[model samples]
Target: MDPAAEAARRLEADPSMLLCGPLSVLHAVLDVVVRAYGEAAETVRAALDRLEDRVLAALACRPHRGHPLPGARGP
Candidate 1:
């Protein structure tokens, strides 16, 4: 984001996190694309989105170890 516009955009849009605007735009495009593919496609797309979100959550929670993340520990 352009630094100059950041303040103004934040004031007007009031995004909860810095990612809200971009994620909102992506969500719109995804909605259209998924709806076009019908119910089964929508289900698959939602599942993929959920999985992607989980992966992102995991990545965000852990520290990056040696550039690539370390392997998960065994139970």
Candidate 2:
């Protein structure tokens, strides 16, 4: 399941979560949020890495060019 849904399910499944006091409940919620953020960051990093590899590969396959004026003669 997705992170948000999973986090909610976890919070809901544990009835004791509410009895732990505001601070403890807050900590649990924050922990879930942080984990979700970390997962999202990893996904973004992987996508960027794939994009960079494709761009580099395309550049590598391009033909090299010589100097533009190599064949020019004095006017």
lDDT of each: 0.64, 0.77
Residue 49 CA displacement from its true place in model 1, Å:
0.3
Give the TM-score of each candidate. 0.38, 0.61
For model 1, give the RMSD to the true fold: 18.5
For candidate 1, write residues 1-74 as lDDT tens digits.
33334445544474554367676555545554555568768789999999999999999999877544478564
Q: Write the per-residue lDDT of candidate 2 for residues 1-75, one digit (tens) a residue.
A: 354566557768886776767765566667888887898899999999999999999989999765558778756
Total colliding residue pairs, candidate 2: 0
Clashing pairs in 2: none
10 residues in a row with least lDDT, candidate 1: 1-10
